[model samples]
Target chain A: MSALKRVQQWATFARVWHIYDASWQNPFKSAELLKKYLMGLHKPIYHPMNDCGDHVIVINSGDIALPGDEWKRRVYFHHTGYPGGATWTLAWELHSKDPTMVLRKAVYNSMDGNLQRRYTMERLHLFPDANVPTNLLKNVSNQIQQLKAKPKRLDHYSENQVKQFPKIFDYPKDYILK
Target chain B: MLLNMNMIVPLGILRNVLFQSKFPIRSMRIFPRLQLKEIREVQNEKELVIYGEIVPSERANILLKNTHPQACPLCASGLDVKHTDILIISQFVRSDGCMLPRRITGLCRTQQKRMSSLVTMAQKAGLMPNLNPANSKKDPKKRFQWKKFNKYFDESTIKS
Candidate 1:
């Protein structure tokens, strides 16, 4: 192959790294999107056993959102294989212990129940915060869109923005403001 | 003698009692001040604290035009209000992050309940940190443990 053509081939064949912001995203939904890239399902020559050169870097995994009270409601079950060794941990507790654990498990549970699942998970890199290493970050060429829009806090708005917003109703003339 | 009495010096106690009954309206105002009182450590007397309210002319001139006159303000506008809609939710909240009572908001029964719940949800999510109490940590990220993380609410999960 010509020198230019060889370089082009390498560029096309090299692994395409994708970065996804886990902030305010449901990890389960994100896992579905990441699964395609990890397994090369989106490629034309995709096979169940085939390996693809794709890396998904999920940042702010600690900020992944759970739908309503799920943090306290959802429980993770574990056992040591000894009699009376069973233990259950709430989602919040687990997240507090390891910020990335919730998203990691969510992504893991979302995949197929087979040995290949473990291998596929290796391609997924989860970060608790937005501190991805420079080497891995440089390779990222694509960003996966979050399913849900990130929520903005009231305090985030500027004072002028809040003040300029239309008033809902004027307080009664007789009523006193606190 | 009558002409001389017209310019006569009025006694402090007699003049006070004379104007007190005639001009009671002067003592009471249209918009009464807050009735909050404080007892200072230095003095035993209770001090009446008068707070200033925003003048009508100085208020936000830009008000949402309510199209529906019959229906409630929220019901009139067919907006799918979400908890994340802090702009809309903040309108129903007080300076201290408390939801305004239905009487003041003038929302219908359903809207009032829904908005209050949405307000609660937003507050718990630390979305209205600025409107919180004086002792609050203004930054949501500075909250304890899991609370410091970014979390969103499912409106459907809210019980009416």
Candidate 2:
């Protein structure tokens, strides 16, 4: 066999596994990363027909981020095919109903609709929390870097720091602000 | 009841008598019946009588099989991971800045993949913060400022 053919054979057979942390990152950003891995776009052996993609295990899907007022303005719609069957759900409502829905939708939309896409999607696994099965964790070869760093919460601040912070304005003594 | 003789008189005899009295010179002429009889005989031999009424057959009504409704979160949302869809990003990430799993989020495999990637893109674009404000070491007052970049001019083209 030719050397090139032998290398191609290896590329077709070998598969890698990846673990991605979605905590505090925007869902759209996460999807761009997943699209690359799922479609095998990052690999030299990547081809449209070849299933050279690696397995992607996503953890902390519940902690994805949103930039602006999408929680109030964005809406999701559903229809039951009957009279008055249309249902319009706000993004917040959908997320509350199912925390993984937003992430799932984001990823699904990024992929092209085809048999290969479906097969690649089968390799994706999602977890809301960090409790992953040992068998799957054993297969994880690497961890995909998160696009953004998580912001600290107010409760995480030290008591001394909070007290040391300067006041923006002072209220007059005995003044009724209300 | 009295019977009228005129009404009871036979029409054939009355016609013969009237014809004989009116003009004995004219011989009685008979219409031809051989053509009529031949046609009737041929029709009787060829015609077939159908006795029963024809009823059309009906097609069977087969009941359709029921399918399970797709309850996957990704399939239900019908939204893609775009920079503008901030609502999805916020919901997917938790208060502690961790992603929710399929068990809680109820997304299919494909959707989970897409969601994570979109989140990463949003973070890289600086549309979303990497860390939660409350948990970060940076001062909250300086945290939300947008980044600005200055345009550079070519040194070769511009005179100092």
| Model 2 docking category | incorrect
Question: How much DockQ does model 1 earn?
Answer: 0.33
Error of model 1, residue A146, in angstroms: 1.4
Write model 1 residue lDDT over B4-118, tens digit each, in one string: 2113233453345546675543433333344222222222234322333334533436766679889887888777889888998988887788889888888999989999999
Candidate 2: which stretches are off by over 4 Å?
A1-12, A160-178, B1-160
Q: What CAPRI-style quality would you assign to candidate 1?
A: acceptable
Q: Report the number of the highest-TM-score candidate.
A: 1
Residue B154 local lDDT, model 1: 75
Q: Model 1: clashing residue pairs?
A: A154-B127
Of the true contacts between chains A and B, what fraction does model 2 have? Answer: 0.00
How would you encode candidate 2's per-residue C-alpha lDDT over B16-132 as one tens digit per residue?
566667555454322232111111111234342222222221111221122333645455544444543444454565544556566545567876666666555444334444334
Q: Each candidate's DockQ score against the native complex?
A: 0.33, 0.00
